[model samples]
Target: MASKTLSNSLVRHLMKRGYAQAAPARSETIQTSVLPNKTFIAGVDTNSPVARVTVAFRAGSRYEPQTELGVSHVLRSAAGLTTGCASSFIIARKLAQIGASVSASGDREFVYYTLEATQDNLQDAVEILASLISRQEFRPWELSDNVPRLKYELAALYPQVRAVDLLHKAAYRRGLGNSLFISPKRIGKISSESLQHFAGANLTAARCAVVVVGDNQDKAALVANCLQLTGLGEESKAEGSKYYGGELRKEMGGDLAHVAIALQGAPASSPASLALAVAAKALGNGPVTKWGADNSVLAKAIGNIGPFAAAGFNVSYSDSGLFGAVLSVPKDEANCAVKAVAGVLKKGGLSADAIRAGKNQLKLQILSEAEAGTSLAESVAAQGLTTGNVLPPATLAAAVEQINESTVNQALASAAQSKISMGAAGNLAFVPYVDEV
Candidate 1:
């Protein structure tokens, strides 16, 4: 009897493991429901003890009106201030008692409130998130108190960080061009009234979603219901962004030089966006280890240009995208690598072997990130906002598999023809002009 039981258990384990290896598509399961108030909920029951929930609003820096610039940044910093139901201290205490961790962040596209806690505390977590978003008290004193914190945080941005910010300004110049961090100059201009008005107009049910990654389906559903009852306003879309590629340059003190060159790419909803992602993978996405070497096309092309580090990226938004490479090198050696990078961009060619390798790497990265709790929740919320649902892993794999040499060449060629959005910060004398590249 004992021998028979042991054999059965071994067979069961092998069957589960073998099936997962044989069919990766079946490994991910998603359940989605849209509430009567137009609040969307995407839930994945991973059966893990720890859970993550995020309420994502379409409110972001890009949505800020001209008169209310930097209000989104202030709103993010003031996430848990005094709500209608509870003070900031009481809110924090409640979450602490339930052993939950919470944070809020804003970007060019969205602002999200994320809560991480045990499955048992999920209900309390949801209530806290709902209260924080709907009942946020935009008192003048509370808003003023967080301004110094924002200033201190903004001061810590390094040259590389500043260069990326300048890159967007060079690329879009307006909507998507909005800075992710609040400018110190504009911080004083933002007022509590502006934040309250911004939240009233943008933080509505039509533009929000609740995403959960955990084992308890019941608690997630309850959270969704709680959000619907908040009576948030109707959804309103932001103005579409137009890409007019130009150049932005700034001189700073660092001995190293930072440069970003970008051209117009495809939007997030476009099928060509998948091809661009695959092309980026082939170009290079950084090395796996500190000591590991990258042998991608871009890496090999610039190998003789002197000691420098570079990575290719494809930044997609709802309406537009920026595809390019960012390079960092010694001040004296910057231009040499920039020329090499431009040459590689103009000739964007990919072999069959490289395409296959890129597909595998992209697949691995997507699946690996989905395995984490908070990451999966964020993915669900962000994708739900964009496409009304998340793209399954298998669908993503299929899209990537269809990419070929011609597809990559065409994507890069289009970018090359567009006006280049160029940025250089630190040791500006050695940085090349956009036309020169």
Candidate 2:
């Protein structure tokens, strides 16, 4: 049995290494700052002339109060409405005419407004973003026009997206989850007056970050223009709390089965975070680790003889972080799947080869993101928010190099002791019967 396991592990390792060898290497420079929360990153792709610009802010859903749940999202939508140079509609239309794309999103931790345009249109794009960030008029008619549309979209997304949102809600506390875009009732309650107040209070120059990725040799002038437009002074302070204090819970219901689990993981700065990520990949990744196989202990014991449409785990980090798995299984096999997952957690059977493969895969995935201008900007922005600096490739390389069998085992042990919060989203009901996994 030992020899067989070792042979299987070796085969998997070689297969994964083959995939890694084929991934292209990416090069980029990431510049970071704290006082102004600015990031200037450039992805050097010789073939593409397209550049991506992003103006990100700390003012995401987490800043929203219970009464103002969906207001941040609404603010993101209205950011470009009527700036000094152009109205939001005209700006969007002009960008489209120039083959540029502009969009925005509000997450639990931040709000990101992005613009992608060709190198020729870089300056115009930056001006457009700067105006949207600093000079948005929030016209009454624009708000009136957009509020209902946003509400309608939110209403439409609720039933379909409820499972993931509920998982976040159960994992993070009520306020944080609501901040992360689960605000059906709050969406209905927001008024244009309240949205204006929220935007004015939160979307200040001090809270914003500008990340430009392209061959814009005139970066200094762009930065100066952004500073002048924002009127950001040294005295201005960004407002918001970074810590989320909460417990994880599992909620089960309906015909479709959803299993969401969360445990307190390492801070973004910890070297062990990479290991924790590798462990998650080992236990949950199907194409990479064979952890989702039907004959595997988890599947066999669950009596789940067929393939799972989706089965994976996610690791989320802020000041504090959570790592957990969510699986979709048939109603009849739900209990078994849960027990099997719990069994793996208890046994801590994560292999060395699996850890190495996961690290390689994750590294490659990060590289792919770097190949895209917008993704690269978001990557740096997220890392800056979490660690107060860009997590450089050298840092990630060192962390991955240090991960081995012993370290992976240690990470698994840490996760085993972690607070596990589980949730179900689909056709079947899931319940946590016992605590000691």
Candidate 3:
């Protein structure tokens, strides 16, 4: 009877902490807490059969020292390669047996690992995560085994990745970009010792956020297990400087013409972030016909190209942030495309329609993600990383509601007046020069 009551408590705790039924009709809620030295957020959707767990550390390439470039990326890959309990291959096989998936990635500001599995395997997945996080043996042999494969994969991806890297390099060449995050030279210099040191320094409980999104009745035990494994320590107080601020540059080259453009934008917490999103969508996103009617200047300029093969904008926020656009076009139309894009940037600020569309799109995107346990987990984890709290649906909805035409226009005007930088990669020889708009 005591065991049954304890079990019931655990189930209740899990439900309170964002675990929910796995079914599509069920609404999901996220639970947040600051436990000892660590902060955690979880979401549980009981109606679905799949569950997701994400753990993030507020450390990434931005935190690496100049001498230890690419260490974060290397460490992320190595985390999956070997933990004390088993080889990465063995873990993968086990996860597959239970219909689970695991992966990790490093970004400019953070490194994250995720696990997706069914309800029955949640405990196993949690244990695996704990082992990887706390008991991983960063053996030399494991690093040696994975380095060649990592290098090969990076080499293969270089051609496609070069343009994106070049853009970031051009925009943020000073601080963060000079670090490993966007520096190709630094990425090539990653070593095993550096990776181990980086992990040890950054992957502390204080710097971590664990998010569990699914329907699970045993959440209290899961939290307790995590706390025991991670051993809550003092919070990390590492501070870093800003990354970008300067004149723009353009590089000309490659078979498919590429243009990368950036302007100073809002911080993640700023209301302007929504405005920027709306502006990006208004210019070049989704089915062009949806927003880009024949009368729209952007549509007229770019011409109806059926579905855009590849075009999107990113509003990257950190200590500093930028609104950036990347477009791929035929060699002959590259200059035209760049100019057209520039014109859009210069003219479009924000509109009621654009704001409405962006809000709807964002809401829809979030809803769609909720259907997938892995995506839901990632969303919750990412929110924890960025805001030091879970993004509540009500808060999100309120923000969306507050994004009116006036607000969007204000954001757009700010974007237009902000400093601009440009980067390009491909076959052209000479960089294109443009006068300030």
TM-scores, one per candidate: 0.89, 0.79, 0.81
lDDT computed for candidate 3: 0.57
Model 1 lDDT tens row, 220-330: 567766764444555445656888877898898677787877777788777667666666667765554455666777677777555566766676777788777767777
lDDT of each residue in 211-328, candidate 2, tens digit only: 6666432453354346453433233132222323333433445554555555556655566666666666555344333332333233333453344433334444454445555555
What are the candidates' C-alpha RMSDs?
Answer: 9.4, 6.9, 10.1
**TM-score of the candidate numbered 2?**
0.79
Winner by lDDT? 1
Candidate 3 per-residue lDDT, tens place, 1-437, comes to 00111122221221111111111112556556665555554556556677767777767676766666567767776766677789878877877777777788656666778877787887877777777776667777767676566666565643224454555555676344633332345443566566656666778766776766665424733643573434333333334434453433434444555556667666666667766665554553423243333333344556654322233354444555566555555566656666766777777564566557666755554455556665556656656667665555555655666767877678778777855666666644433544532
Best by TM-score: 1
Q: Report lDDT (CA) for all predictions.
A: 0.71, 0.55, 0.57
lDDT of residue 245 for candidate 1: 77
The lowest-lDDT stretch of 10 consecutive residues in candidate 3 is 14-23
Weakest 10 consecutive residues of candidate 2 by summed lDDT: 14-23
